[model samples]
Target: NNFSKSQSNFMDTMLVFSSGTDIRNLRQISAEIESKKGALVENQYRLRKSEVELRRKMRDFNNMKDDAESDPFDVEIMEIEIQEAINSRNGARTYIEAALKTILCMKQQYDAILKNKGIEDVTEIDFENEEEEFHIKKSTQQAFEDIVASGRISVGNNRYLLQIGIMPNLVHDYWIKFLGSPNSYEKKKFDEAREALYQQLKGSAIKEANTRGLDELFYENSCVRIEHRK
Candidate 1:
């Protein structure tokens, strides 16, 4: 029962950090999107205003050209003004299109992150409560010990454990403790340990998927071999 409790606590702690970090990221991205949208609207307005000015300039040039008494120099200046207006309008239009593309890409990212978090709406996020809930009360050393005791570091679960649980929650200090003293040798050891864990987990997950007939859903390149038992 104690082991189970320790595992539960470790997972809860990891989840708090993971979920809270994602929500915070979503909020930051939302703010950026709104700011960009405002700029896009301003640019659009400028483009429209430029179009009106261009039309008015063209009309002025036409009227000046028809006036026989009008100075030749003045008519030439009007033509130059109309050309400048056309350039300005074109630039504004190009900028607006590019801004629109950027916003579309950002929105796609926002949606992807939202789906990963299993949240439908950004409006539902409560930042104040999220911070309070994710605040870790335990010291780094204690948390590390809890992780070691969790017994969740086995095959088929490292994908979640490493990617979602440990990587998000652990800092440099935690890694130093985890992988041993900082040195080239230690780094090599760390890499080897990680790769070994990944291979074990991948194989396990693939086997489980095959047994459940969910291989295609989970993996695109998994090879299934028919075992002939004689």
Candidate 2:
């Protein structure tokens, strides 16, 4: 019964990824998308079950009218529980919505790439062009990485920032990334440039007791990590 309810809800809210343009990859992409959407619904179902249980306890307590009015402490605790449950349910819904949007964006990008390659009706010439471009891009990225490692180029003074964004509380994965490249700092000017890029951001920015604790600063910023290749 719960599974049926979740399926119904999932189908209603699913961000459609199909465009009917490319028949070759549609089946595979559609299956994967459906699986991803199903997992989200399953997560929501579990969260809502806990919420319903909390609400039931509140209801049962209220049914005992005399006891409910007499005990103020327990009643207050139940009220807090109900509020938290409401928050949890709402958080799950928000998470599902965001995930769907992200999924849709990724699918569009995938379709665009596929169309650019002209793989809808692939030919020998198309395969040759793809192979040539792949090697060129790969070699270019490798060469760029090598140049950055040489330390001959004066990279400038800059601070390395780690930004993290948490959503759906503990249920979803926390997004973490470097705000900018640590290599942007000049190697000659900054003595710590070589090691700072790897070592400086290892510990927590927030001071407590443990200087080793890194997770403490994760929720400080509501930011998503974006990569920019120069």
**How do the residues 50-107 of candidate 2 rate in per-residue lDDT, one tens digit apiece?**
6787679768668644573557777777778777877777767666766576457546
Model 1 residue pairs with clashes:
none
lDDT of 1 by residue, 38-146 (tens): 9889989999999999999999899999999999999999999999999999888877776666566667767877898787865432553343223221222233344
Q: Would you list the C-alpha lDDT of every candidate in the order shown?
A: 0.56, 0.44
Q: Model 1, stretches more than 4 Å misplaced?
A: 1-20, 132-175, 178-230
Model 1 TM-score is 0.52
RMSD of each: 18.8, 20.9
Most accurate candidate by lDDT = 1
Lowest lDDT 10-residue stretch of candidate 1: 132-141
